[model samples]
Target: MKIVIAGGHGKIALRLTRQLAGRGDSVLGIVRNPRHVADVERAGGEAVVLDLEHAGVDEVAATLAGADVAVFSAGSGNAATAARRDRMDRAAVVLVMDAAEQAGVRRFLHVSSINVGCADDPGIGEGYAVYLQAKRAAEQHIFDRDKLDWTVLRPGVLADGDGDGTVELTAGNPIAPKRARFDQVAREDVAAVLVELIDRPGTAGRIYVVVGGDTPIEKAIDV
Candidate 1:
C-alpha cells in the first residue's frame, strides 16, 4: 500500500516510515525541512517538502495524489506555546483532512493524545487541559466528517523502550489509574501499529488507544 505521512521528520513519524518501508510498502513523507529528505530516504521513504499549516487544500491534495492512506502525526512539541500548538496541532489537522478528501484518500489515521477526554483530575493540570482542548477540537472535526474512512489512535504517555507491540486498547472511555510509562514501547512499536491499521480493514471508523505490552502488535490491535 502507498502511504503518505505528514510530519515525517517527527520522532514517531520517522519510526513509522522505516517500519512501512522495510515491509516493502511505498511510503511518502511530507516534511517541512529539506534537510529531512536524506533521513527519510535513509529510512526507505521518499520525502516531499510541504508545510501543512500554510499549504492550501489543492496543493496538499496534489501532493497526496495516488496515495492510498494518509496519517497525521504532526505536532508542535512541548516547547510550543498554546497558540502555536493550536495552530499546528488543531488547524493543521483540519487542513490535512480537507486535502485528503479532495485527493480521494479515504483511509486516514490521526495520532492523537491520550490526555484528551481525561476526567477532571488534578493530575491533568492547566497546561495539559489546554492541550486536551486542542486535541478534542481536532478529533471532533474528524468525527463530524463522514465522507472519509477515519480512525483515531490515542496513545498513552510515550515511552522509549523495547516494544514487543503488546498494549491495551479501549474503544470509549477507557482509563487507567496511573499513567502508562512512556518508556514502555519503543517508537518502532508505535509505527508497527500504524502500519497494521493501514493494512487492516476492520479498524476503520474506530478509536483506539495504543501502548506497549508483552503481546505482539497484531494482538494488541485486536484488543
Candidate 2:
C-alpha cells in the first residue's frame, strides 16, 4: 500500500509511518518544517515540505497523486488560539478532502479527537472548544463527500508507551465517559489500529472511538 500522511512529524504519525514503512509499504510524509524531514525519513518514509495553511489545491493535490490512502494528522502545535485551531484542524482537512478528490485518492483516515463533540459538554480550554468545533466541521466534510471512502478515529488522552496490541473501540456517535478516568491510551497502540484499519476494507465510512482495552487490536474494532 502507498500512503501519504499529513503532519508526518507528529508523535502518532511517526509511529504510524514507521509501522507502515517497516512493513514495506511506500510512504510519503508531509512535513512543513525542513528540520523534520530527517525525522520522517529516519522513521522510514520519504518527506515532502508543504505548508498546508498556505498551499493551493493543485499544489497539495500533486503530492497526493498516485497514493492509495491519505491520512490527516496535522495540527497547530500547542497554540491555544482559535485561529490556529480552525486553520490546522478544520481548514487542513477540507483542503485535503478537495485534494484527495482531485487526486482520485478515495481511501482516507482522519486522526480526530475523542474530545470532539463528546456529549457536547463544552470541552475544557478555550482552544479545546475551538479544536472540537473544527474537528466536527472537518469530520462532517469527510462524511458528506460522495467520492470518498473515509474513517475517522477518535482516540482518548494519548500517552507515550509501547504498543500493547489491544484497544477498546466503539463506533458511530459514541458517548464519552463522564468521569474521563479510563481514557488514557498509548500512541503506539493507536498506530497499530491505524495500520489495521488500512488493511481492513470493511472499516470504510465509519467513525470510531478508541482507548486501551483487554481485547486484541484485531478484535477490538468490529467491521
Candidate 3:
C-alpha cells in the first residue's frame, strides 16, 4: 500500500513508518523540519518536507495525490502552549482533511488521545483543557464529513516500553466496556494498531480506544 503521513518525525508516526516500509509498503512521510528528514528516511520512509501548520491546501493536496491513505499524526508535542494547541491540533488536522478530499485520498487514519471528548472547558483554566478542546474540535471536523473513509484510534497515556504485539482495543466510547486497563499504551503498539486498521476495511468509520492487551494485534482489531 502507498501511504502519506503527516508528522513523519513524530514518535508514533516514525514507528508506523518503520512497520509499513519494513514490510515493503511505499511510504511518504511529511515532515516540517528538514533536519528530521534524514531520521524519517532512516526509518524506511521517503521524506517530504512541508510544514502542515503553515502550508496551503493546494500545496498539501499536491503532495497527497495518488496515495492510498492519509494519516494525521502531527502535533505540537506535549509541551505546546495553549494557543498553539488550537493551531496545530485543530487547524492543521482540518487543513489536511480538506487536502485529502481534494487529492482524492479517501482513507484517513486519525491518531488521537484516549479520553478525548467534548470539553467541559467553559470556564476552566487553559492547562489540560486546551489540548482536550483542540482534539475534540479536530475529531468533530472529521466526523461531520462524509467525503472521507475515516478511522480514529484513541490510545491511552503513552509509555516508552517496547510493544509486546498485543493490544486490547474497544470500539465506540472509551468507557463503554470494562475490559482492559486502558491507562497507558506503548507507542509501538499504537503503531501496530494503525497498520492493522489500514488492512481492515471493516474498521472504517469506527473509533477505538486501545491499550496494551493479552491478545495479539491481529486478533484484537476485528470490527
TM-score head-to-head 2 vs 3, winner:
2
Compared with the true structure, what per-residue lDDT tens digits does model 3 show for residues 146-220?
Answer: 999999888888888688999888887532232323388899999999999998878888889888778899899
lDDT tens digits, residue span 1-223, model 1:
8999999888788889888888899999999989999999998999999987688999889988999999999987787788978988899899999999999999899988766765344677666766767887898888888878998888777766556666665564323223423424466677788888888878888888766667677766762
What is candidate 1's CA lDDT for residue 56? 93
Q: Which of the two candidates, 1 or 2, achieves a greater lDDT against the reference?
A: 2
Alpha-carbon shift of residue 132 in model 3 (angstroms): 1.0
Candidate 3 TM-score, true structure as reference = 0.92
Full-model lDDT for every candidate: 0.81, 0.86, 0.86
Between prediction 1 and prediction 3, the one with superior lDDT is 3
Q: What is the C-alpha RMSD of each candidate to the true structure, in Å?
A: 2.7, 2.0, 2.9
Q: Give model 2's TM-score versus the native structure.
A: 0.94
Worst 10 residues of 1 by lDDT: 174-183
Residue pairs with colliding backbones in model 1 are: 158-182, 159-182, 159-183, 160-183, 166-213
Q: Of models 1 and 2, which has the larger TM-score?
A: 2
Off by over 4 Å in 2: 118-123, 174-182
